[model samples]
Target: MAHPATDDARLPRSGSALDVAEYFAPQRTSSEDLPEIEPLVKNLTIGVLEVLAGVREVDQLARWLGEDAYRALVTRSNLSARARSARGVAAVRPAHRILTQRLCEPTDGVVEAVVVVAGPARTRAVAMRFEGWDGRWRANSLALL
Candidate 1:
């Protein structure tokens, strides 16, 4: 039997489109291009919970929120009542843990996360949207349900 030619046209050659180089090349993604955001979300969510529980003052969240959100939160007169209701049977400082977190990007520089928080006596879902501005994550919107 005769051996096949090493330069056979059927064989893939280096730098060809069929080469695996392109497939293995490093991929660029939005997440990679942007800064890390999940840890910010976690901390912000915890702070929001603390505010809702009245264990933390709304002013403490000011730095994390945008101007509009901060103003709205600060002016809301019912936070104390809501906090009392959420506290339920737990003490002044309830143990809260994140149960689930889902994240998505609605647009560039914006990340939204829906998180479930479980406390000693109650559980609630919190949705927070963050925008990357001035090289930091700022709360664009926050809602509790």
Candidate 2:
């Protein structure tokens, strides 16, 4: 008799046992991997700000955020229409910054962060939460400040 946990038939066709070991290894928490994840963070933050500012619409936010985040953004917009319009960013500067916190459960995933975008007159902080869905990081919720 064989145990289901050790089912050989369900294993990958390629890669040795050591390969599997390396695949699940703990990820590095240095800025070395930051560049790879930068676009997702920056794009989503800018898009959210644009939507709040009325320069962009709600539907446009779907590209960077998940359904829940989209709904949350819409609700926030409705709640404070005047503020969003007044504080709308004129232009985002070239050098925005991202801060990240690694997840505890899984090995390699960034679950949350704060993105700072500098405009002509003001700097806005976009608090974002992300989830690994379909092998990519998708925004789950965002708050504009």
Candidate 3:
């Protein structure tokens, strides 16, 4: 009998296993081999989710947060910092259906991302930016996103 494709095997082919490997392979951002964006994107996503669900306190964030994200959220929750920034809120939250465009590395150290926020007759690009900080690509700004 032949083996079935596992979950990760379903990724879009990069034309060959070598390309596929290079595409998904972990590269060192800060000496460790974690894919730079995954964890940070996840933390940012969770913070957004919690805020949308009316959990605004920074302490509500999980401690396992990738550090850069932890600090970003902390700054966001601080009255002095949050009040100074003119940021917009997403009209539809995650439970409503959120889509993420695959992140692309357009330059040497920066990653560009497009998160689509969807609602009835509405779709908006939540433009996100990330920088490699201590081995992870943490959200630089939701306001910019």
The best candidate by lDDT is: 1
For model 2, what is the error of residue 116's alpha carbon versus the real structure, in angstroms, after optimal superposition? Answer: 1.5
Which residue pairs clash in candidate 3? 127-145
* Winner of 1 and 2 under TM-score: 1
What ordering of candidates by lDDT runs from best to worst? 1, 2, 3
lDDT of 2 by residue, 37-60 (tens): 556776777667666655667787
- 1-145 in candidate 1: lDDT tens per residue? 4346665765666677656766676333344456788888888888877766567788877877987777666655255656656767342664789999999988777889999999888888988888776566788788778
Q: Model 3 over residues 63-108: C-alpha lDDT tens digits?
A: 3344555576566556433443445443333353566655777766
Residue 96, candidate 1: alpha-carbon lDDT: 87
**TM-score of every candidate:** 0.65, 0.54, 0.45
Candidate 1, which segments miss by more than 4 Å at Cα?
Answer: 1-34, 75-78, 81-91
Candidate 3: minimum summed lDDT over ten consecutive residues — where? 88-97
Root-mean-square deviation of candidate 2: 9.8
Give the TM-score (vs. native) of candidate 3.
Answer: 0.45
